[model samples]
Target: MASTVSIGNGYGQLLRTRGAWTYLLPGFAARQPFAMLTISIVLLVQHTTGSYGAAGAVAAVTGVSMALFAPWSGRLADRHGQRAVLIPGVLGHTASGLTLTALALAHAPLWALFAAAVPTGASVPHIGPMVRARWGVTLKGSPLLTTAAAFESVTDELTFVVGPLLATALCTTVNPAAGLVTEASLTLLGGLLFAARKSTQPPVAAAGHARVEHASALRVPGVRVLIVAFLGIGSVFGGMQVSLAAFTESLGEPGLNGVLYGTFAAGNMLSGLVCGALAWRTAPQQRLVVGYGALALTASGLWAAHSVLVLAGLGLLVGMCIAPALITGYTLVESLVPAGARTEAFTWLTGAVALGQAAAVTAAGQLEDHLWGGSGFLVPMGGTLLALATLLALRSRLAVRPRSRTVARGVGHRVPVAVD
Candidate 1:
């Protein structure tokens, strides 16, 4: 009871931090587009081109672009500042998103769509990672750092729950282009707003290090393992987005896609809240393995779900398994990498998920196109099992090194991390 009360108080204290709400609201809005992008692309492209394969391919292009470039953006932010990186990013993303929406609506060539998608994906502001970095800066030496991580994880899960449903509703009820239009508008407005709150932003990590050699976050062994594990989680997300859409469309109830997917995301949000509220006795490493094992077990049942009801139930179970792994993975980052490379480390993990989601979307789309929706479900099961095996084999790499430095304080302490 005391632990629970302290956890609750931790949240209360965090919210009470001066100027915290200023950036948090805008950050929340800016990051919603991340959740909306793939679904919006899948819906819009599939609507125009009439092929899930084409839709997936176009979306994959954007995902691949983002995955390739996000770390570079993070590195730049670490060297320069968040404002410098964000100004161009939000502007470019808005312009590119609008262009892609126009080309798709105009029935432009596949190459044209693919070309526009590059900048659209690459310029995503990564506001989640930025926000978490801000928390690290603000709560550097406080025990509230872990609480902040949990809060941010819950926020991210909430976005997943809301963003997709909003996009789906706009696409189905208003027009196919509405979702994309809103996404761009929100990106432009919210990104700028978040960027404007410069007070909360972390200072450039490289400011004092004149010509100092900075190491890449990729050099960390644990980061590589988490990236691979997150790839499996991404597969589930990508597979569910495409497969759920295809399944519902075949039933002649396309709107149900949002409802079912929302249910799945709701489970994720619920688990995040529960995970955050608990006073954990087990190590995050142990939690990670257990979480992933449950995820794989739940995913194995997806291929067997033929009805909407069955799929929703299995998806909820699958969703429930994700937060523990994700929360644990991000928490692991603090123990794994140095403070100077923290943003880049966060982005690398984010990029891995994007890359994995892109691959899974393409593969699942192909499977659904040539085979059946049931076959589409196979991708998640296969991807998770394969990645889970690698995680088991490489689990030793995730252990904390004896030489430690706290990311924010320069003192040695384990602070939990989270994403947008």
Candidate 2:
């Protein structure tokens, strides 16, 4: 067992790895667009069309397209390579995003906006999952794998904090379309830089590992459970995006939207850092359950928050609960799925989150338009409670499988299995 004192040393070891910064920095830049997209679409469409429902509908289309296609892209990355998949994806996303921005600003009909959104979203490179796959190969059997998951979760939260703040500021102060425009520019530049780092990319599954490569990652029982749980997390995110904006607008303090959301994301980042630094005696499955329960409880109070102060406090608490759950869930992925299928498995979870967020955005936007912002808050609490019940009922399905990785033998492949 590692002592608490090992926290700094643990992360330090990962930082000290040769060429780590090459991929890490560009990967960080490439992922900002995901955090920026939904809010940017929501803000811009709402500004141009004067309807939250329409804005959410457009954003939902984008989210759904991304959700449907992410796993396919991941499978291709596994079969071919990350560079091949990311190059065209990055180019297509940049072009499509620019088109969507133009259409929105021109007040083209809703159908045109939705049409442009499809390609805009579907081309989003699953950079975060690809980065995690790289980390998996780089540190295969080390205890630092768990630390790496925590580190990635922290990086995700940091992007959320910065992305929203930047997008919101650009939309509010510069131009309504500024957020999406800047997002496309970053995708082009950062994605190309990341793709050029060929040395760090995970090798394509060799022909000898064909059996493992051909099998779908979804065949694992645990991956399905994690996907559903991640969907609930996505609901919280999507619900909060629309609700917080509506609430702040109602108060004539629209700028607070970024501040409040940033507070929430900051909480997530802080807790992720703490999770990485600790050495735990309990299993990740247990931690996932407990963390989710806390998330559900904190989320329940959001609808009753009538003041900004109260809402911010509750948001921070809810955010804090998320990292432990996310970190543990990703940690479990390492054990439940085989090496060749890890990228696809990660994309499945990512896609599930996107799908859930799309649904929540549509539902919450309708509630905000017809009822009130408070009504939108109900979505997160309800989604989490229902998912928590499902999780409890299906908890047994999340048991970690025996550890296995495909190793190349002379003419074939064999998996060296280890007991967890």
Model 1 residue 135 CA deviation in Å: 0.6
Q: Rate the local accuracy (lDDT) of all candidates.
A: 0.85, 0.88
Query: What are the clash counts of all predictions, listed in order?
Result: 0, 0
Worst 10 residues of 1 by lDDT: 411-420
Identify the candidate with maximal TM-score.
2
lDDT of 2 by residue, 10-84 (tens): 899988877889988988888987789999999999999999889999999998999899989988898889999
Per-prediction TM-score, please? 0.94, 0.95
Model 2: colliding residue pairs: none
Tell me the TM-score of model 2: 0.95
- Candidate 1: lDDT of 419? 19
lDDT of 1 at 92: 96
Model 1 has an lDDT value of 0.85
lDDT of 1 by residue, 119-188 (tens): 9999988888888888888887777776777788888888888888999999999999988999999899
